[model samples]
Target: MKALALVAALLLGTAAAGRPPEIALTFDDLPSHGPLPPGETRLSVIDGLVAALKAAHVQHVWGFVNGRGLAREAGTAGVLEKWRAASFPLGNHGWNHSDLDKVGAPSFLDEIDFNTPILTGQMAGQDWHWFRFPYLHEGSDPAQRRAVRDGLATRGYRIAGVTMSFGDFMWNDAYARCAASGNDAAIRQLEQTYLTAATEAARASRHAAQGAMGRDIPYILLMHVGAFDARMLPRLLAQYRREGFRFVTLEQAARDPFYAADVDPRLGAAPTLEARLKDAGGKPLEIPSYSEMLGAICR
Candidate 1:
């Protein structure tokens, strides 16, 4: 009995010392599917996607549910309550999913205004400080980024950008085309593209720091909350795990200075999300539609 107890204690100690998860799963457009084209078959897909996340124990999700969409699909009261119930972190996508830069500051601020009431009213005075620029375009001008930053400052919003990149769009296309073309075409494409994106992102970040990209940098991976993305979650996680990455949430991953451009640990300016996006060719992926230049995002 004494020998057995000693062995059990050693095993427990080894298990307790295992590394914590390091990858952050950030989902955009909470429950926002593409255009509702008639026969409602996607509702289940959405549910399945959410179920997968829940099953994987993914607690924090950055849901970008537009107010209008909430009223239309998941009813504002119910969606708000459900998200809050899940303890999922919420952020404003925009008023109506419109482009912030094109509309200018007045209209942009209006977008913030449009949702503030709902958040304050339904969530009971919940303050949302994180803002995702529509289409991930901070602004057309450096001043515009500053202006949007100032707007967030006026209302206490945090400007978020992305760190690691992926062809999440292509993941879906591959599945669809593979089904059409037969075989595990989507899976194969996903395997190829997924590895490419991950490797390339690592390379880009390393190059960006001029040779500091390692396991230490907190990586913010961008993923849409679409069915296909959710479907590919397991395999994606496995791939990253093999590459020696652990799963974390946006709040934790965004803490790294590489992803957060200006978080001064001294004076305490929480690092904002700012990273240079690169295409598969290792060139800069332009805004308005990145990683989609090869029609990877669209079917």
Candidate 2:
């Protein structure tokens, strides 16, 4: 009996060690993102995205909105309506997707304020107090960062921190260019490179998390609602599955201690993996850029 108990314990430990990592998917620049391809409308792009998410069983994706898009593009408001109809939550990106480092705190806060009504109406009493910084620029200096952080907290908003991204948005315009010219070969190349980048980024992010925090916390992956992303999401989700990542909600991911500050706005600034790596005197991972190749190929 003692030998059997020991064997069971060892098996359980091994299973626990082999558990997959968790990641939450969040899309920025809702309503519109990047250049639309030749045959795609904004609604069509969103419909495709919603279908892909549903097919992957990814419930509770958060779509961050920039209110200015609704006002600028006719019929774009329906994109948010369709997103809500799918039962996904919406958060504020900003009124105009302004950069805090360039726009200053006062203007940035006003941008947040301008975006509030749209979110309030769209959310309809659901919790919509999450804010994803435009371009992921918190601020240029400590004082500026503090001012914006304080402003967000005062407005009852918690910051959304990004731990993983593969520059998915960069592929959209290139895809559009290729599609316009009916360049099937170039499009195939783009698809291959896109997946390669995403795979490498996942590996690098895991390494960074282990090196910085000494363990893997649940990761929040940043993505954009661009045309190419909608086209490739089915395969991307499959790739993550193959790499042993389980999809989670943003709130669920935030429950990890690494996201404590992000979960509670009143806490101090969240510690990023990059900052942690710098403090530990470790070098950052150098993920290769496909921007030049992406640009030159399709054009």
Candidate 3:
């Protein structure tokens, strides 16, 4: 019996070694996701998120800051400091989380420039030069996209791209709504839905990469900082682990060949991988829109 158990363990280890997905964990809207519940403090939410990350043994994660979000909540500026103190890297999410598609190219560039001082102070000389588009909306037109891209290039900023996200932003808000109304049943459903969506999203990302590039490149997963996210993180990390993911830093994820695609400096941007695939004339994986996903919860 003991011999059989030893053989099984060996087989399990070998299987685990066969296919391990690499992903970088990234959070947006640092210091706050939206508004906090009446009694729960932002500090506590940050503490919970930090604790969960530590428990999951995630060494290096990235959090992008919306300077405007920080400014809205008094005494919440320390959230970024806490994230840095906890050893996570910080990036700019624009001053107001403005949409580049709706906002003109010049306005977008100004927002990026505007957030620098705040991020610089929060980073304290650390390398904090990455920028994530507020809504993943690169630009409405090619010229605008190129303009912003060129602007960021001159500013020493690398645009952070997301390859995996379950629209946890929508889930978070729905979860909050349910919680406020004390809808325990819906809250439970939300938790399960969130995890299931994450699992499926991981699969879709792998398929997208394989279909588009014939290989699975390291993926960047986008999430947010919120009370529900803090609560869900420990489980989310475990879910990723079970799905064969090894957490990586944003910098590390960028090292993949997929991230090495040359900038076309063209108009009409898509997801990083999708744009690359489309440029190569390969078929990109199709996933549901955010509104489609949100409708599942709301309806």
Instruction: Report the C-alpha displacement of residue 285, candidate 1, in angstroms.
Output: 12
Q: lDDT tens digits, residues 1-299, model 3?
A: 34323433443353376666689999998878864544667788888899999988997788998888767778888788788899888888898888887789899889888888887887788888888988888866877788888787777777788898888877767766676777788778778767766766776677667667777788999999988888789988986776667888888888775665322222224456666676667775454454554455533
lDDT of 3 at 211: 66
Q: lDDT for each of the candidates?
A: 0.55, 0.86, 0.76
Residues forming the 10-long window of minimal summed lDDT in candidate 2: 3-12
Name the candidate, 1 or 2, with the larger lDDT value: 2
What's each prediction's TM-score? Answer: 0.68, 0.92, 0.85
Clashing pairs in 2: none
The best-first sequence of candidates by lDDT reads 2, 3, 1
Error of 1 at 98 (Å): 3.0
Best by TM-score: 2
Q: Where in model 1 is the C-alpha error above 4 Å?
A: 1-21, 35-43, 71-82, 121-127, 173-215, 258-299
Ranking of all candidate structures by their TM-score, best first: 2, 3, 1
Error of 3 at 51 (Å): 0.6
Q: Which stretches of candidate 3 lie over 4 Å from their true place?
A: 1-19, 261-271, 275-299
CA-RMSD of model 2: 6.8
User: How far off is residue 194 in model 2, in Å?
Assistant: 0.7
RMSD of each: 9.3, 6.8, 5.6
lDDT of 3 at 271: 52
